[model samples]
Target: MTPASPTPPDASRRSRGSIRKTACCLHRGYPVDQLARQCDFLEVAYIMLNGDAPDEASYQTFRETITRHTLVHEQIARMCSGFRRDSHPMALMCALVGALAAFYHDVLDVENPQHRALAATRLLSKMPTIAAMSYKYTIEQPAAYPRNDLSYAGNFLQMLFAIPAEKYVLNPVIEQAMNQILVLHADHGQCASTTTVRAAGSSGANLFACVAAGLASLWGPMHGGANESSMRMLEEIESVDQVPAFLRQAKRDPQAFRRLGFGNSRYRHRDPRADILRETSHRVLAEVGMSDRLLQVAMALEDVALTDPYFVDNGLSPSVDFYTAVILKAMNLPSSMFAVVTAVGRTVGWVAHWNEMHQAPLTIYRPRQIYVGEGYRDYVSRRGERSAELR
Candidate 1:
């Protein structure tokens, strides 16, 4: 079983909005930025769930444990086959992830600690497999089996791109980019999806169901599609030369062409995650061996945002979303799979938070709200004249 405290691991110094303003609140003693850049995805997840980095021996066992569960049941593969060929990958993922709980329904006693640990491990391992299956199904291709020999991220890439005839020889650059991408997005404190996961988990739902809720939350463009939107914004600018004209329009009518990916409430200055991703963006692009015009446009925008007085004064800097779009584009993944991929990375966090939420006494989350609607009004049926006048 995964090593963890019986109670939810304490956030070292988590303030209400600290993570939104700057770097992640310390996980136990480790800063997440350092973990994202240097460690593998599972290593970072171990830290998040266990409250400390694993020793060499412990990590080996942990790694083996994670890999052992990577393969979803054959029934899941057959189940994925039932989806429409044109279904969105996220839609497919949301459905099948929830379906996974049905197969394991016998042991879903959420109160059992070992059961919770098993559930967490299963989810951390299975989500990528499901995501890859969803992608393959969308493209009318067969799903690839998970490789025990590959690292977590490497296996995911292989499952995603490897075909029957040509085995995917893992490229170091590609694998490194994939690993960092997963690590970088593994967690950001209490985002919409994470909150949804916790809220669902608080209600005594199974892990798969809670995580599926998180997946559904991420399906919306506002949360999960920002990077894709960033790509769109960059594409609209087309060539680097067109950025100036686009900026002029943005300046004249801010609402007409809203600039995305330049800033967020999460970081007042440079997003530390963006800095880490930027360090490797060029390397991945070079490895991709294609001149991506949209990536060029993104960098052009980055340059302007960095030096422009307007952007500087407003604290508008490039964000993690923009760099993600650049790297995923260079890696040649479809926009449809972008959010699905991100959710795969973030499953670690979702699981970690759920584990934490269930540590002590579990309470179904109940948020109080004041009623502001018309009060003590008689029911307005269609027969009423006012009801006939308006909805």
Candidate 2:
């Protein structure tokens, strides 16, 4: 009876149990339930990997530290000028993430708890700078320096679009929208890329090396790649009238329609998060006066799909990505940059999870497999073995 497939293990026994024991990256004993909602990506990240939310003082200090490091070091700024404008932002993002390793090689080498804490601090501090610089260079703009007084989201906004010719005024709505998206994407129990980060970090690898591995995993289309897919789907439909026909085709042949942005995950019927993002999309779309045919089409499709029995039974719904793409697109970001935005928000969680694994009574991740190959044959002399094998 296959040994009755072993009983579910306790969270406290993660170190002793086989890797297949857990369903996802979530450490069962950790306070994942408290964190999966209510916290922003940064806060949840700190909680998961660090085992506690930052107290007011720590939160303030960490926020300040991150703000201080939000602009690229001048050397990185110079190097970025080398890439062509048409290059994909992810290529530049990967290079920049790796470049950070060079900047803090000494910090990474420190093994003391205090020193490791500083390394974590530096990484959290520098992420926005690295992400912002990548965006600026890809668009051929002089990097906007980070402002000390602005909120974390505000500073990222400035770095992305502020120009020498004009002062960049921060908009409250846009910043809130960005923060919401970041919070929603903070971490997913044990996602593929996050698992990659943990596996790489397991050997006591430095944070940069681990984060690079995570970024590579995020580059897969089924994961972060869906952000671009969401935008493209909206564009393909192009207007409200097309929504019904598209819905009909999709319903009649789900294989043919596939509902690009709407149906990807376990929370079928409608993502609670989608309602929030949809509001933001509307606000941004109206702000930008973008009355594109695609927007109308997407809205129409959403209306039908939300009411459709097909989607309800299937446990599929428009995800956070669907609304997020429209909001970002309205804010003037290219689809290529969508996943990078996801990566930036996710870095906080990634680093935190890496830290969490370190504090755990450490286990090297090794999954087991049943042996299924043919039984081994006895060794023999080359020619003798060949003749005897047939018999």
* Top of the candidates by lDDT: 1
With a 3 Å backbone cut-off (N, CA, C), the pairs that clash in candidate 1 are 20-266
Which runs of model 2 end up more than 4 angstroms from their true locations?
1-55, 252-259, 369-391
lDDT of 1 at 327: 88
TM-scores of the candidates are: 0.90, 0.82
Winning candidate number (TM-score): 1
The lowest-lDDT stretch of 10 consecutive residues in candidate 1 is 9-18
Give the per-residue lDDT digits (tens) of candidate 2, residues 178-266: 77777656666467888888888777778888888888888777778788887787777756767777676667666324445666454
The weakest ten consecutive residues by lDDT in model 2 span: 16-25
Query: Looking at candidate 2, what is the lDDT of residue 201?
Result: 75
lDDT of 2 at 39: 48
Model 2 gets an lDDT of 0.69
